[model samples]
Target: MRRSERSMRPRRAGPVGRGDRGYVTAEAAVVIPTLVALAGLLVWGLMAAAAQIRCVDAARAGARAAARSESGADVVRVTRAAAPEGAEVRVTRGGGLVRVRVTVARPRFPVTLTAEAAALDEATVGGGGR
Candidate 1:
């Protein structure tokens, strides 16, 4: 080959390293599952928060019913209707105050949420007539 011809030809790039091959694929393999796990955690967190809000709502509903002098069965029924599925409700009255507590268990996570509400009982608001 002539010297001028060889000089005019393009120089070849350096050989690629073994480690560099499929680097992007390896990175993606790790990153994709991590991203999916993060998304799942976010969804679980949202669900847990929603369950907590439902517990709060249920407690409030039960407290209101108890304060209004509703029967015990009615108070429980209203609270359960307002609560999230598989929740527990408890109502108690003491010192003119009606307290309602609601608890819910998370489906995927090993977590529980509890909420309490209190209201003045109507019967205790006024003294019996003389």
Candidate 2:
């Protein structure tokens, strides 16, 4: 081949230069992972909040039921039904009142949330010292 023909041959581009003129791919690589992590965190937070609310509601329901002369086992059943998945429920009744405690455990996260509730005696609900 002639010297001019060799010179006319195109030279290969470098990594810094060529069609990739901007940081589009690099920027996307950083931004996408960050956005994905943020989304995961947001979903986890929402799940935790929902679990907390369910735990509280479960405790309140169990307390109310037990206060109305329902059995402790029944209270536990009701609490479990109302509570979020993987929740532990404890019910105690004495002195014409009932108390319920709920503990929720998150499977994906290392966290536990607790809620406690009490229901007043029927006498208190009706009137004091009838």
Top candidate, metric TM-score: 1
Q: For residue 40, what is the lDDT in candidate 1? A: 94
Compute each candidate's TM-score over C-alphas. Answer: 0.82, 0.73
lDDT of 1 by residue, 1-130 (tens): 9999999999977786865899899999999999999999999889888888988999999999999999999999999999988888889999999999998765634787999999999887767323
Q: In model 1, how large is the Cα lDDT of residue 127?
A: 75
Instruction: Report how far residue 69 has shifted in candidate 2, in Å.
Output: 1.0
Task: After superposing candidate 1 on the true structure, give the runs of residues whose Cα lies further than 4 Å from its correct spot.
Answer: 1-19, 106-108, 128-130
| Candidate 2 C-alpha error for residue 8, in Å | 32
In terms of lDDT, the best-performing candidate is: 1
Question: What are the lDDT figures for the candidates, one per model?
Answer: 0.90, 0.83
Native-vs-model 1 lDDT? 0.90
Compose the digit string of candidate 2's lDDT tens values, residues 1-130: 9999999999977776676666798999999999999999999899888888998999999888887777767878999999987788887666667779999765634698999998886756656556
**lDDT accuracy of residue 47 in candidate 1:** 85
